[model samples]
Target chain A: MMDLQVKLPGLNLKNPVMPASGCFGFGKEYSRFYDLSLLGAVMMKAATGTERLGNPTPRVAETSSGMLNAIGLQNPGVDKIIAEEVPFLAQYDTEIIANIAGSTIEEYKEVAKKFNDAPEVKAFELNISCPNVKEGGIQFGTDPDMAKEVTTIVKRASDKPVYVKLSPNVSNIVAMAKAVEEAGADGLTMINTLTGMQIHLPSRRPLIANKTGGLSGAAIKPIAIRMIYEVREQVNLPIIGMGGIETAEDVLEFLLAGANAVAVGTANFQNPLVMPEIINELPKTLEKYGFSSVHDAIGKAVFV
Target chain B: MRKVEMKLVYARQIAEDTIEMKLEDNYITQIAEPGQFIYIALPNFTLRRPISIADVDREQKQLTILFKIFGRGTASFAAYEPGMIVDCIGPNGNGFPFDTDKMEKVLLIGGGIGVPPLYYLGKKLKSKGIEVTSILGYQTAAQVFYEEEFNQLGETIVVTDDGSYGEKGYVTDIITDSFNFDLYYSCGPTGMLRALTSKLQDKKGYISLEERMGCGVGACAACVVSTKNEQGYLKICHDGPVFPAKEVIL
Candidate 1:
């Protein structure tokens, strides 16, 4: 068997597979299905300064090959996570990446400061791409200046590496990715859900209560692969590629697209054990392709 | 909590839009408590749909699920017949809490598809020698189901919203008029559950809430409910899909 480890700048993952933020929910529930420690890392749900009730009912809608969600970053606030969730997650062997989201830069600083004190959290994934919330969602990622400012502020507040998650809703994703990288971000998680909508025929109204939502799953993989390739060309920083990764083949595409690491998102909704399956399959895929390690596959297909 | 593979032994249509599926998965049957649900996946769908366990035969390692065909995914499920292979992840989420030794009399109330879970709970309570009274509500006589099965378990009452069945009006109205019990348990649409909670506010009971869930596990916070807890929110998929009435806001 071949080694499939990939080093992402300051971070070192056992394999390229990770559970995307919001989808994995901090890894506790998934532990029941399989040992979560087997995965490379677990991204906690996007946390804020206060508990959020999230959007109204019918927060999700089914799309053609994917689904749309407007969960509005419903979290147990930074205080509760530090006091409750972190301590429990500390027991797991996998890397714990605190995914932070906020309505303002100060709130982002406050969350980062709390994680600074907790030894359990290895890194922070700044969620500047949540499209559901009215404030600090896609607004921050769409503007290069706002993205840089927020990233710099969070970077200064935390001692841990900061990975800024970029939204695909913007016109120039490369510009936004470069902006965050210049602001001192350690890496980037590319292509959060794309903005989309669904309508109910009988009611003659939108299917989602929030009207518009972020689309994810298999439908967005092609776009995500293209974006990862684009970002990899412009930025020197490592990229966490994700969108509609459902199988090992999908993970390979992301690696070949220059993602130092890959996060499993909507696939977890289809199969909770998807991360493990991808992790176990990567080494086999690597050997068959005549690659010595997973890192060799990174950017392999980008030039082609 | 072992992750065991289950095979779909048979799937048969019980009504016009209702399908009853039986799986030969023992982990679910042995570990699943009444009122708990299973998340089933269709080969083509991107997400899994959760359906409550209607019946469980632990001795035979069989678990039955009753589902109504409401959309594309469910409609596809209806096409599945006996021996079709299907995947299921469960018995996830908490189930109804009942102490038969302590509570002598129990009331099981359900509305529409909500009636399915109560049937299982009533059966368990009956086995423990607890007096069980079941009230099942539907829209009309034609839509009413499982009245006979529930009757076999305990004293059963039927109510239809259009006055086309045993008792006219809502299930709560029937509960107010006919039966009295030490404890109550219910599952239904949010409106029905809220109405019952308000009518029986001073009383104590457990109510199961239905919400759009991302992960049927506790992690997503998608199935959160307002609670009296300091955190103010609780994961229905993990904490208690079955919550005490007082803790729930509505």
Candidate 2:
């Protein structure tokens, strides 16, 4: 038997395969496909200070191997998520990773503090890199000092382990990762969607409603692995790596590239059972490297 | 509810850039309703295209879909042949509710790609001995299809934006003061649906809608439409690809 357990700062995951925020809703929609507890965790949608309907029609555009989305973070707000979505998720024995997004620093602090007493909420994945939004998203993620400030504020308000989600849009990833770690982030999630756009041929207009969207799916896997490799070398915090991770082999590659865990993003839209399928197939994939435990794969691709 | 791989029995282009394909599947044939649609998973495409179920042959255990060449997804589907297996997850979405007794004198209206699902509804109503008046609209004579199939069910009227064939006008042009209908069911573009729902105000009916969908099971919230409530949004795929005209904002 292989040991698939992963220990983050305060949470112990049964496996490393959890759906990324936005792709997996409050777990109610996916609960129909399989047992919700089958996942190591469930990253809820990016909740805001208030309810938002997001951008208008045509929020999605299909790309080569992935898709682009400018959903603009449409959520029911932090209070509703805690009062309603949290109680429903309590039935499932899974880690509830609250992905909080805000337009201001005070909004971020308020959202983080709302989960300070909730039992269903186990951790916070600060989504500072959501490329689809207009404010307090990629803006906070692109700048190191701003990233540090938001991370410091959220970490101060919450009792749970706060994992700062990093964006791949910037030039210096190591500097950003280091700054977040210095700001007291318990861990890091590498490679949020890269900014991209598409145009309609005949009409010659932007395809998505927001004109630009976040790129995610199998097309961005290589970039995610490279960023995870770079950040693991500089920061000592636990990392949750993601981007275009579709199969079990991709998860192992990210694990060996130095991610303590991995999150399946756009793949879930294609197959809702992807997380369970990957979790079930992880052992068979790990045996190829003769590793009896999951810890053996962490940072194995990087030479000491 | 289950992901089934169905063998394509036949795929033929019935009209200009319009292809209708039939697949052998029992689960969908048994549970699929008039407005319910299926999500077809293409090999290279990341997202599945949601096509409405045109007709179902329960005895033969088959499902048919009529799709236009809107993008690369449908264009690829046009190239498919018999014996090829297609991954389909469906009999999905809340289809049109056909339980109302007020539908004795039913007016069925559809435009463009939206015309197919109404064929199934027309046949279902006819089976219950209900009188159905189907109004199908298209851009031109060459674009109109399923005329004879809809005609077989009841009194079918074909209209076009341009007078290439049949009546010359939009589907909404058919709704006049003297033409009293107890109920109506429509499917079309947002503009057409908006016109139909508004012009036929105070009349109880349902309208089938379309949106850019993500996870067709209501998870992604990508295909949400504005609802007349505090929640504000309802999923087009789950809450309904089919909704009552009075309930939806559009």
Using all chains and alpha carbons, the TM-scores for the candidates as numbered come to: 0.95, 0.97
- Tens digit of lDDT per residue, candidate 1, span B1-250? 4445678888777755878888887577888888899887788788778888888999999988898888999999888777766787788788898877779888888988887888888888899899988888888887777888998888888988998888899987876644668889999988899889888887779998877677777766666787776767787778878899889775
Give the candidate number with the greatest DockQ.
Answer: 2
| Model 1 chain A: ten consecutive residues of lowest lDDT | A1-10
Candidate 1 lDDT, tens digit per residue, A198-297?
8899899998888999999999999999998888888998888999998888888888888888888888877888888888887887777777888788
TM-score of chain A of 2: 0.98
Supply the global lDDT for candidate 1.
Answer: 0.85
User: Model 1 - which docking category?
Assistant: medium
Off by over 4 Å in 1: A302-304
Worst 10 residues of 2 chain A by lDDT: A295-304
Report the Cα lDDT for candidate 2: 0.89
- Model 1 residue A230 distance off true place after TM-score fit, in angstroms: 1.6
TM-score (second chain) of model 2: 0.97
